[model samples]
Target: MPEAHGTDEVSDARPGPIRVVIADDHALYRQGMAIVVELDGAAVVVGQAGNGGEVVDLCARLHPDVVLMDVRMPVVGGIEATSRLHAADPRIRILMLTMSDDESDLFEAIKAGASGYLLKDLPGEEVADAIRRVHDGQAIIPPGMAATLLQEFSRLSQAGSVPEGPEPTTLTDREVEVLRHVARGMVNREVADALGIAENTVKNHVRSILEKLHLHSRVEAAVYAHQQRLVPPDA
Candidate 1:
């Protein structure tokens, strides 16, 4: 069961709200989640998919900013779909929003290029917040798995298997610090507070980090941070 601590209503002042695609094997669950996800008008469900294949096709035709994917489905699975979608368009953020809490599923999803993994039983508001957060370019790993992810990242870093991207030296010291916080899953506001800077300043630094690193979102930046050994890959 899911919880809802806060009211669902929210204000989205952006010219266009976050575009989302919900892919799940269960129709009823999808229907219910769709309501919660769009309750505040912060996100719009541009498409609903019964499986990973449908999502891939939908994405090919209708681009969405975030994808709420299920781990297990017929014809294709979320992990494989994530890989295909990422290969097709690295800009789309794939989040494994499933019922599975298995460590393998969690690790595999990230390996497949998913920005985050979340259980369906989280609060409704939390779910909504996640859609917005990932859309804003921040990673969202489950709390239980953060430490383990860091360990694996460290192991991979030591093994020299992390993917190659812009070197950390390409970014200034502050941008690198901001990237470090982002890899640790800190939002702009949180990062600002930590660094004793304004939120807008943090946002600027983040934008610069993306541009300099040739990355699309904070999720990718988190991967970069780990590739450069910045963070455990975070909160």
Candidate 2:
């Protein structure tokens, strides 16, 4: 793992590498992550911070492409940190990396502007890939978590915490079909294969879906699809 720290080395570095910041309370884990993310040569660890406060500072100075944040920390938690950093700069992609699967944390992370929520148990390679995907503007909710997230949203809606929005009537039937596949955690290529359509067509459908629903990313679209019950309840 690269022992290099300091935003100076990373801040002025050219834009080729997907600059990353690994924020975890554990020193060992931060070192491990620095190694794993750079293994593929697609990303480089620009900085490491042990707490949320430091993360915010590093992000301000380094301006990384993605931040791997832990939920639990001494001074500030990941959710609050993500909220602050995201509010400051909406473009910085924050991916929550934690051991907790608590629905509350997951929902809160999403609410705080996280691009993705990933369990720490995921393989390092998967984690690296997730960072890249998030940087590329894709949302990375694990398959198991997706259903639970929908359930959480349903409960919140039932409690009237989430204001009801008008149904998205603008989406065509095929777009709706594509949405269901995406909500079920299928990528664009996967959705295209399942629907027997071209990948570019699926991309167009996704773009249209996001635009029609006024959604930002596929993660939000998936959540919207579930909240509207666009797919079978049993699904």
Candidate 3:
């Protein structure tokens, strides 16, 4: 199962509270989670679900901005649900909220299409912050997990599983700079600040990068950046 954790802050340049849906088999826990999300004031709960199927139904119906999903549920599991939801709507962010910290779960969650994974024991404040960060297009991986993820990417690269994308020549000089920061796990605002550009400009660059590269989320862009050596491996 997934749980909550922290990510870098997003630029407040984006307006409005992020829309969310909470999914968990336990009614009380689900309700409590809804309360926490609402109390945080950064997100509004648009729906709730008790299983993976219900989550897909709610997401299709409501088109929420994010889904706070738990991994363990009857009928379907969070990983499957996340994969389904992501395939259906890549724009909808999915954050896994469960108690499992097993590396295998983490690896599967990423493969299953989760934008981020968190332990259920994450602090309420950090959870709220992570919602905003994920909504703002940042990939949320715990500090320690990042190394493991990177190592996995290396293994995949060695196995020749990573796709050979467009040549780096396709990106503008500015976009290359932005990708460097993004691959470093910097939020849009951070990229903007690093490149001394406006936040919206950074967003534009990100969009262009995704379009030119045919990638979906910032997480994919980050991984692609590494695999393509857009940024130095040691960095």
Q: What's each prediction's TM-score? A: 0.77, 0.81, 0.80
For lDDT, the strongest prediction is: 3
Off by over 4 Å in 3: 1-17, 100-102, 184-204, 231-233
State each model's C-alpha RMSD to the native: 5.0, 6.6, 3.9
lDDT of 2 by residue, 118-211 (tens): 7777777787777766776667777667667667776776577866444778889999899899777677788989999998898888877877
C-alpha displacement of 164 in model 2, angstroms?
4.3
The candidates, ranked best first by TM-score, are 2, 3, 1
Top TM-score: which candidate number?
Answer: 2
Cand. 3 Cα-lDDT: 0.79
Model 3 lDDT tens row, 161-222: 86667887899999999888988877777888888999889888888888898775666677
Better model by lDDT: candidate 1 vs candidate 3: 3
Residue 189 CA error for candidate 3 (Å)?
7.2
lDDT of 1 at 136: 60
Estimate the overall C-alpha local distance difference test score of candidate 1.
Answer: 0.76
| Cα lDDT listed for each candidate | 0.76, 0.77, 0.79
Q: Write the per-residue lDDT of candidate 1 for residues 1-235, one digit (tens) a residue.
A: 3321111111222358888899999999999989998998999999999999999999999888889999888899889999999899877888787665545677667778787877888888889987786776566766666656666755676688766687788899998888888777677788899999998888788878878877655655776787775765333
Residue 134 displacement in candidate 3 (angstroms): 2.0
